[model samples]
Target: MKLDIIDLNLSYGSTKVLNGLNMQAKPEITALIGPNATGKSTLLKCVAGILKPTGHILLDGEEILDKRNKELREMISYLPQEIPDLTTLTVMEVVLLGRVNSLSWKVSEEEIDQAYGVLEDLGLDDLAPRPMTELSGGQQQMIYVAQSLVRNPSLLLMDEPTNNLDMQKQLEMFELIKGVTAEKEITTLMVLHDINLASRYADQIVVLRDGKVFCSGPAEEVINEDIIQEVYGVKSTVHFHQDGFPQIVPLCSVRCLPWQKRKDQGLAHQGSVDFGQQN
Candidate 1:
């Protein structure tokens, strides 16, 4: 499936969130990375049809502005940054909510099977009977991701999906998301905070700044240190792995030259003193 954003403009009350934004998303994971308040979430919300934009979005070449709520919801699934507060439902019950948009009155047997499948795929099958409020933060995140995927959408938009996940679970989540998106042939766009993971997993990366796109292209072209510093205002050293994927090492504040500050004081900074060298 293909999703197209055409000069999308969105405003809340008076402030514009997306200013003439444009993008084309396909059946691959696209990472939207930027600093805070840059409207990454706003762009995703607009594309998902949660918020009506001033311009148009095309789903499979059809204008989304003309589509109704159920029609648009069927085509796209959106996972918000914060988990929903549903205390009355079990984990599986909450996941089954993914199908509620299609239900006329009652949930179907097929929907039950689909929800269970999503839970198992997300490693949340064991938590099926637990209350929504009883799960850990990472567990809740996984369940929410499962809830979004249970719909088998044409496009999935995740807003900061790995907010509280540990390092191990984070890797697992990315692997699972990649597998699902590939197997299901669903286009995935997510607001990712981890640049390294985005570089490794996403086929496309879009950088945003001040409600506008700073730069966007393949992850290879957009993951350099220059773009990082330019978009994030922090000095970082970027290194490429053998596979040519980029990894970023954020340095100290951009204000001072630490080496120069040390040298100016004549503190006997010896020649190439490698700390804790075995030799």
Candidate 2:
């Protein structure tokens, strides 16, 4: 699937969220990255049909912006940032819920097998019978990802999928997602805060700034020192790994508030400035 966003716009009352946002995502891992409040999550919600935004959103040249919620849910699988606490449900039950649209009064054997297949793929098959509340944050996160995958969607949208995961789990999850995306030819769009991870995992990186696309392309074309400084207001060194992915080494913030202002406000001493305070 190929997703095209044309002249997209969204707002919360008077505050605009997505302003004329445009981007193209194909059947590959495309990372949507930016600083906070850049509309990265908002865009994903819009595509998932959780939020309505004025625009032309086309899936392989078919307009889907006006599609009904049930219709859109069939074509797109969305994993939100916050993991839901489903204490009453087991991992298997949660995973099966992904196919809720197709489920009848009795869940067929085929649906159970399909759900198990996704769990096995994610190495969570053993956790199928366990209560969701008994698992750790990372384990629950993985189960939600499994839930999303069980939908067998053409387009997958994940918001901070690796939020609660450790370093190893994060790597494992990304590798799994990338492998599945390539194998199934699913259009995957992920909202990621870790730019280095995005560069390493994403086939294409889309940088959003203030509700619009700042820059987007292959990591090599978009991940550079100038972009880092401009988009993130941080000074960083960009180095390529042996596998040809860009690794970012952040040094310091270029937009940190002045020392005098911090001192005058009694937030810091005269000689020391708070790097946490940004313009």
Candidate 3:
């Protein structure tokens, strides 16, 4: 499936968060990368249909704006950033909420099995009986993620899915996401702070900055130092690791060249400033 967003705009009262933003995400993991306050989360909200855009969104040649809530919920599953205060519910019960749109007044065997199955895949089976408050940070995150995956929606949109997780758990979450998306042939889009994770997992990358799209293309095209510097105001070396994905190495401020460091250090040098040894 393909998602085509055309000339989208979003405003927060008086402030404009997104301005004429547009991009397409195909049937693969597409990553949204940008610095803080760049509308990354706002863009995800618009894509997930949580926010009404100024323009239209076409999914597989059909307009999403005309669809009802239940109809929209049938096709897209969204994992929002702010996981609510669900301290009272058990993990299993929370996962069942994702299936609500698919459920009737009575529960079905398939829905129960599907909810349990996804919880297990997300490595939350052991914690199923425990209340959400009893789980650790990573476990809570996994449980929330499981809730999103339970419905098996055709399109999955996530905002900062890997935030506040340990390295091991982050890898585990990535593996589960990769396996499920591949097995179900689902189209997944997510916003991520870690460039390495996005590069390694996402087939496409979109760069957003200051309510506008700096660039939108494959990770290889948009993850370079220039784009990073332009959007993030930082000098970075994007390392292609093992032809799998790109990892970002942010250089130290003292290590940047004269032209690069001048922007931060307020130096007025014209030519290059060699920070290397004078040999």
Candidate 4:
């Protein structure tokens, strides 16, 4: 499947969030990375139909905005940044909720099996009978991820999916997501803050700046010292491992150029300072 976002625009009352943003992704994992307030989450929301935008969102060359609610739900699954704490439910019950649309008067055996199957795949089967309140935050996040997967969505939208996890859990979650999404050929768009993690795992990377795509391509093509400085305003070194993935070692934030500081003070300079060598 291919996702094509064309001339997309969104706003919050008067303040614009996304402005004529265009992007394309194939059936693979694509990581959206940018500084704060760049509308990464808003873009995902528009695609998931949680928030409406003013342009065409096409999946496999067909427009999806006009589709019915059921069709839209089948096509996409979204996990927001903050998942509400519903400790009263069991893990099995929570995951079964993903199939609420397909359920009738009684929950079927096949649905229960499907929910268990997904939890097992994520190594959370042991927690199925446990109350959600008894598990750690990372464990609950995994349960929610399994719930999203049980919907069998063609496209998955995750905003900051690794919010509360420690380093080990984050790695485990990414490995699971990569394996499952690739095996099922699902198109996933995720907003992530860790540049190194994105470089290591993402099949494609989209860099957002000022609510626009500053750069986007394969990881090696888009992630470099120059782009990092330009888009993230950070100095960094990028190196490739033997596995052929880029690894980023961030140095420090880019210091303000002399000309910019002078300009801020309402003064003009005869010669401009070279930001390239400023750091």
**C-alpha local distance difference test of each model:** 0.86, 0.92, 0.83, 0.89
The TM-score, computed over Cα atoms with residue i paired to residue i, of candidate 4 is 0.88
Which 10-residue window in model 4 sums to the lowest lDDT?
A: 97-106
Which is superior by TM-score, 2 or 3? 2
The lDDT of model 4 is: 0.89
Structure candidate 4, residue pairs in collision: none
Candidate 2 shows a clash count of 0
How high is each candidate's TM-score?
0.87, 0.92, 0.86, 0.88
Task: Indicate which candidate wins on TM-score.
Answer: 2
User: Which residue runs does candidate 3 get wrong by more than 4 Å?
Assistant: 101-105, 253-279
Cα deviation of 221, candidate 1, in Å: 0.7
Per-residue lDDT tens digits of candidate 2, residues 162-191? 988999989989999999999999999999
Per-model clash counts, in order, read 0, 0, 0, 0
Candidate 1 per-residue lDDT over residues 1-279, each given as its tens digit: 898888888888898788998888899999999998888999988887778888778888989887888897888899999766876778878888888852355998998899998888777798999997888888888888888998889889999999889998899989988999999899999998888899999989989988878898887798877877777888889888899888889985555577778888876566877677586
Look at candidate 2 and tell me the lDDT of residue 186: 100
Residue lDDT tens for model 4, 1-279: 799999999989898899889999888999999999999999988888878889999999999888877888878998888887678999998898888853344788998999999998878899999999999988998888888889888999889888888898789889988987899999989999998889888999999988889899889999889999988888999999898888889999888888789989998686758567554
Which residue runs does candidate 2 get wrong by more than 4 Å?
101-104, 258-279
lDDT tens readout by residue for model 3, 8-48: 89899999999988888878888888888889999888877
